[model samples]
Target: MAHDASGGEIVAAAGTTGGKKAGFFARIVIFIRQVIAELRKVVTPTRKELLKFTAVVLGFVVIMMALVYGLDYLFSWVTTVVFGVPS
Candidate 1:
């Protein structure tokens, strides 16, 4: 049993705890099977959906950049006022 960062209990899968270690090749096979299973679960977005998601992400990034720049400018101005401007 393992505790995650959030303190949730994580139980080990059956037959995996204190079992005889699988050989290197057997481990590789199991990894490949898990990879295939995960790949099958992936959903590819349609072209329109992809474009919309991209635009939204770009817009959000731009907005955040503007916000950070404004905050930095405000802090700089405040600092200049608190202390004499650099010569």
Candidate 2:
């Protein structure tokens, strides 16, 4: 089975091969059909699950931002010590 870029989970549909280039409108129709098909396969989370996911994401982002800020502060302190305080 063919693998996608992120992982081996995504495999192209069977027998979906490239043929002659489609016309502009034909390509647009094909794109819309593909989008709808993918959307149909999507599984949306429940309200509670969505809230939990959002909280986890926000917490992780806050933690990461704090870490980056801490590191930046540390580097700036070190730089100031090594080069003397700027006027």
Q: Considering every candidate listed, which one attains the maximal lDDT? A: 1
- lDDT by residue (40-59, candidate 2, tens digit) is 77999999999999999999
Model 1 per-residue lDDT tens digits across residues 4-86:
44443334465785655656786676667666666777999999999999999999999999999999999999999999688
lDDT score of model 2? 0.74
Measured by TM-score, the strongest candidate is 1
Clashes of each: 0, 0
Residue 17's lDDT within candidate 1 is: 59
> TM-score for every candidate vs. truth?
0.74, 0.68
Off-target runs (Cα >4 Å) in candidate 2 are: 1-21
